[model samples]
Target: MLAPLLSDPDTVRAADEIHRGLHALGVRDPHVQAAIAELPLEDAAAARALGRRLTRTGTSTLTVNVGIALLARLGEPEDVPYLKVLGLLRALTRPVVGALTALDCPTAALVWLADHAEIRALRHLIDAIAARDDHEARTWLINAPLDSGAVGPSTARRVAEAVQLSDILGAEQTDTQAVAQAVAQAGRLLSRMTGLRDYRPEILSYRQATTTYTAFVARAGQLPPTPDHYAILLSVALDLHSGPSVLLDWQPGQREALLHALEAVLHNESWTAVAESEPEDPAERRRVHWLRRTARQPFHRATVSRFRVEATVRDPADPDTVEARVLIDGRPLVPEAFGKGPANSPEYLLDSGRLRAAAEPREVQLAEAYCTEGCCGALYVTICREGDQVVWRDWRRPPSRQPRAELPEYRFDAGDYDAEIERAENDRTWAWPARNTARLIAAGLREQPGLLTRWDGQVGWIGTDFHDQDSTAISFTYWPGLAAGQRDKDGPWLQFVWSLPDDGTPPEHQAATALRQLAERDPKTYAQVRGGSRSHAEVLGFPWPEPEDPEVTT
Candidate 1:
């Protein structure tokens, strides 16, 4: 494709003019790559000059892409500097990264460019770093795996594999700083590897995760309690409690030993003091509060039952929603196990009628259709507390749904089930503004269900909507209509919108106001709402009325 351009003695050789010529000639990437691959030595030198010139001076992305592709095939190490410069343009990251990798770029230059590269286009850079036996690259990966924000938990495994994390952890010559950094990185890595995020690999992906965690616990005891160390330890501790089944990948005693070690360090008086003080960093503060809110519980297996259950907050942005997954004998009981769709939202599972054991066997909805629940039906398993055991049996789907074969029943240690539920419930690290409002309102209703008696409704689902730039509208969905206290098979739904200021007003205070408003207001006076309509609290004359002036008679 470039034969005519390379041979023309009178052709304008300026980078822009050449770029324009290439565009005019309708040259494509494959044509350019093919022509560069077959070019003669003298012609290759001229092409390299053209590639270098265009890469350095061209403003158009198409021209720069062609320049970088040429360099990737025929350029030398001397071109790494300019390639690194061009890597800054996120638009040109992929082509520039490829070019830099092909030129045998210095490890430092590669690392610098990788820092600026997007995670989606970072595999080549990571592989380039991994290919070299460079200590610098290994150290960088250990200390600051997530620092650049170039890679998230989803892509961190690539970084872990690139550094040969398992080899480093098992090596006899690994130094203290490297081990410590590895421990910290591994904690963050494992914490995310749990089934919380879709497409993220589980902790089993890393063979040495168990060792790194144990090492982290040991290192924590040796160092003075700090926000960073405490945060890492606390996060990993929560993950151990509620993440995927550890015994599936860990040795028999390893899970207990690591959990015990973590408990010791996390609950140490000195560490507790630091955590209680509430560190300034937002992330650390969230991590530390989990321990602050819950009592210290022992990490031990109560019964020999093989059932393990965990509530996963798959969507942190929607914190009020969660899903429950079970592992029997270290094997997942997922939707795919029975040809179902996905798991149902377990947000209301803790309401004494779902996963929480009850005196009578309760048929709980476990998994549901990927589409609407009514259309494709849901999966149900009967759960009940039988003495020291939490038994799950009679696995079936919605009436007439497939899977005619009866699935096996499971009996979990009641102690283990309760502990896991508590851990998952207390995990407020995923909390946000909307969830906070919902949580407070839910707590208030739980404390006083009769508060909505005047309205003749029960809270169904609580959510929030953007009211304005500085405030939000807390919405509550109630069942069986309002006022008349009527009931039917399906029942009707009503919504109340409470607009609250974002001026740091306590959520509990908002909850209190909402409760009081619900108790005092006559739902009959409010306009009937249908579809997506909502009754605004301010319009209903109940928005935290201002204090009245006290009389001097007092």
Candidate 2:
């Protein structure tokens, strides 16, 4: 009966019958144990029988070990579920991970095991995957939920270490998809850990840091070009201004390599071109132009700081007029006149003006005092005066040769613009025509920090202490575009203020504030000082103030 059961073509059924018979004969019986151990493990029938015996309540450690060894040796991918159950019960050991690896377990299975498995077991699984040292295994490891903080710190550390090691190997692998996957995974991890949401910069740097991009580009270049390749290259160029991150530490020769890759992508005549030549499609032309511009600029680490417009005041004598003043890094910005001008000449007068005039305020203009080729252009504001006070009503770009139909008609409210700026800063993809729109907004604020008035279509100049700094602010009154009947209401005009903060604010703001004071007290010399031409410390005539650690303030 035992021989017939063992010899049956149905391996699972035979194993079950043998297990029942062995149970009836007493599992602890040395004869029964010997019989189970002696069964041929190479055959599916014998291996199932051993597995059944090992799972039984009274199975000995020696029998369990033997069963696991046989299963590891003979298990097919289908057998992984059963082996995993046993693995969970016995603690996921090296042998179990090795068996799973051998079975070519899917990533889902490994992840499921990770979710249910003990920490030690998970670490061993990570090691097992890393040990495979191939693209698929490395890709799986790259996407593992190690940073989810579900695991203890020690385990997370081990997993991170394993991934880093695997990444080094993954970077060297010839698989393009796998390498891209690794780069994306590393980028995501770095962004999450650093509280940064944009990973384009890091993704672009992967080729330089890991050689993954280099490998991918070489393989991709050999194939028929796809839109995906164009997109990849474009992404690299567009994000060139983004600084390096922990995972994508820039290295020597990386920038040059990136430029070469851009050129290679451009070499595909169907996608982009050099010199005066351009793609026929306007959108394609724009894309190529953006790429070229980004490549030319590259990434320059600039310390940006934030400032706020603390107040907009009416000149005591002029009720319809207001003067703009900004508090940057906690100091007031007063414009200083430069060039060949006496103390109160037009050049000096241009440095300050009436924010509004005594008329029905319809429009206001703000011009940058230093209108050089490199400087940003002017800002225009529209306004309406309420009883006893004035309020900024709306913002419109200065008229240009571009057809009014081509210009966007949306009037920007200061409140909305402030919110949008904040959103754009956090999410680079916040709006269509994102970077350009942001650039225009920033330029308007930087170049024209003061307000001038337009009454009956004629322009009138106004003055404010608004001036240049590492940071500055702008204020505008919003018009809701109400009906004629609704125009005479309680809140016809709303004032909104916005500030551009340094990359790290408050501290930078304070430093900027100090510098502003230094510049203002000695305008003759400091008026000529430009931010990039000299160090802030040298220009300020003192050591550059360090951002306070822990950032305490008065």
Candidate 3:
């Protein structure tokens, strides 16, 4: 799955797009070089996105630097310019940066620091930076003494120059203040590079921390819980596969809304059926609101020093049997920990039941894991919807009735459902470009007005039988109706949840009728309709009537 990226022009283009944007920002030279350096460090797709961010509109040096550092781990050149760039970034206050850099840091920075940094001041500065990071960045910086030839003003001269006489480690220059600052800064950088980014002693402890952190992000209500944040959370989850209950601090009754939007973002599937016209600022805000209001889950709030949410699976049909357990801290958290969706996660998890594909559309199964279980760090946990519901029973189970794409949520004004479906469903004439299903529906109702409400017989020899609310087949019931032991085989897979539109009626009506006619015209469309119990079983397929529209009447 990760292979195609090499030749995928879109990915290269996305990467190119980012690089161009980076050039426009003040980060053109050293920054791009640094990112190029990190390319060997991360995955190609990640590298591409990083390049885009570097090149994207109005990207900050900090953003570019982060991109470069992560990419470098994928395996970028460790060069002079990259090192110089690293020296420039050494001036920030983030712990994550340190560890990330250590994975694929610009090689040049460490060498220069060893050569020219003033000894007395080094201790103080490194300490300052390390302390700021809660000791995370400091843990990774071990000593590799300066070589006499390592010092030079050519590539990263600015680094040497800035090493304040205080930063200088002279035999006699014993300024405690200078030494303290350098020490702090060095320590901070080391923590980031090595053992500090959310390091922990136990897995359960990390889960507790994750919940607390997530809740913090949720409660702040200040940040947008922006798409990028969602993406990071997703990446973290993919990395974790299955971690502890990740409690998130969310405003009471707010977290639910983000789930759907997150789902779409994670899977790259389109959810364009939103009813309300949306504004440009937040792409899926409306959809997010809908999901939150209607997520079919059993979750309750737990409050103590902070607020958090605990979700439990109550629906028998819900496939993601295991739910994410999360805890929250009332305090506001950072943006990276905020939402449930992210465009950046490598593979988006898609919910099979929610997919809306047209009939016979190519099948696309999309579900990917995220995470490892060494169990010691700021873990990422997410509620995954992809393939959670479909227990694909491998080849043993019959093929599914669920299509890969979901029909856009159908809508209409009162009586217009028929008009809309007619327009959406069929058009018999291929020569007429503008021909729609309008004629077909008119013909169907004028002929069999009760067609939508009618049902003929069971679809095939199946394993289950079900009853319905109305006389028509839209509603149904099922017990043990097994032909070859396949569910929905006798019916629409027998009580199978149809993924099509509700054309003011159940699919059974149209489906039964369509089968009859398809057989009449072309028996090949459904060659699998051979039905009968092993002994008394005979071909019990729908009868196909001949005509322009089988279900339609003049």
Candidate 4:
């Protein structure tokens, strides 16, 4: 690819071809750099010209990255300003940071770029800034490392470590304001570490977990409680009390003392007044409500229990596969301390038999370990409806672990239990675009399974699954009534892939069109069906019988 850029008379044409070629092949920045690295560095002028041209005129991200990497290796210091401007773009941040770092750009340059960067981009620059003994960078990091957003909580731990939070908190001369901010940030970090659905590095993984948390608690005691402080204290306290003891990697008696200290600060008159006042701001009110509710109804509130269903990426490596977990009174329902693995998605966790109360005692898997049930272990609980109460009992541990503290069975009022279950299941507000698309298709298929009858003799609708950001698939149990597993070696399964348009078409319209087409035409005629299990499964593409009228549908 670079040979063409180096030899071609028309640099613009060569760059455009390389960009389109790499974009089509789905080659990313690193791949481009590897290719460029293999080429001779002697062509410094060509590299600079190609890099400058691509950086200025290239539309695709990969093209600009190639230019940036090339220039980082061969260009002059004059390219610094252009690279800084490129760093402002989120997609280009990593390569731009790399280019600047490669060129040995000043810490102030990186800090300037960090000002416009999101938490994720800031993450790339944090280590470089932290490594350099720049007071400006240190001050900026200590004060503004985190923001109040989804990415903020996940990145809190990294930022805390970059700024050496434990040392700062432990120092006698550390500024009071910096100490307070770091403590509050630690609280958020701890909260994220305690989360159940997401498979994140535990709070204990941080070498300074004990020192940081204990120091935060001690300092929290000295400060007056504000509404924000109350929320942080309450959140940390609730998780510490309810979460697994393993997460409490504090010094002996430190956990207990911290809890006592938090309780005192939280129950103090100032905090109580803030909680009771119910501030007009919605975010503040919600925080206040949590404090008020926790104060009134301790850890395990009787009569009614609150259930919040949250979806977390099961593996950071694979963000598409989300795992859903239930929050029982704001603490994870799954005992994460027991080496629990990721649970199924929202539909599988809530709609599956696990959450339903039946007359007969039925066992269900709450979570599995990382390896699997056979190799590692899994958590199981039995549920049965006894009179007007639904009781969960007979907790089973995975076969491979040591005997840890047993989780007590929960008993809930049937009415309250049923309502909570339905509420969480019905709430689709947390769903992503792909999930919403799957749900829309699933609903339509449930009402009309006959749409796929012509595809095969024994096709049974299983459920919808997310394929990617813009695609979803509806799978089915495809027995075919053949000899046992003759048709599908791994039992019976078939899926119809629905690739949605990039034009901002609403999900309802997409689902309606797909359903109408399935009903009108025989899927077997147009669908390209391939056989095998889901891992290697080749899904049939859902066909469009005709062009859809945009104005006719919502």
Q: What is the TM-score of each candidate against the true structure?
A: 0.62, 0.26, 0.21, 0.58
Q: 388-427, model 1: which lDDT tens digit per residue?
A: 9888888766656454766777777888877766665565
Candidate 4's residue-wise lDDT over 404-507, tens digit each? 88778777788888887776677665454445666677667767666665455334333333323335554443334342334654544443333443234776
Which scores better on lDDT, 2 or 4? 4
Task: State candidate 4's TM-score.
Answer: 0.58
TM-score order, best first, reads 1, 4, 2, 3
Misplaced by over 4 Å in model 2 are 1-195, 198-224, 238-242, 245-254, 273-554
Maximum-TM-score candidate? 1
The lDDT per prediction is 0.59, 0.39, 0.29, 0.63
Best-first order by lDDT: 4, 1, 2, 3
Best-performing candidate as measured by lDDT: 4
Off by over 4 Å in 3: 1-211, 214-220, 225-554
Per-residue error (Å), model 4, residue 166:
1.5
The per-prediction CA RMSD against the true structure, in angstroms, equals 10.9, 25.9, 23.7, 10.4
Candidate 1 Cα outliers beyond 4 Å, as residue runs: 1-47, 115-128, 147-149, 166-179, 198-200, 214-218, 245-247, 280-284, 294-436, 440-508, 511-554
User: Residues 267-313, candidate 3, lDDT per residue (tens digit)?
Assistant: 33222223223436432442333233323222222223232212222
Per-residue alpha-carbon lDDT of candidate 2 for residues 41-91, written as tens digits (9 for 90 to 100): 335656555554554432444444444555555666776776666566434
Weakest lDDT window of 10 consecutive positions for candidate 2: 452-461
Number of clashing pairs per prediction, in order: 0, 17, 121, 0
Native-vs-model 4 lDDT?
0.63
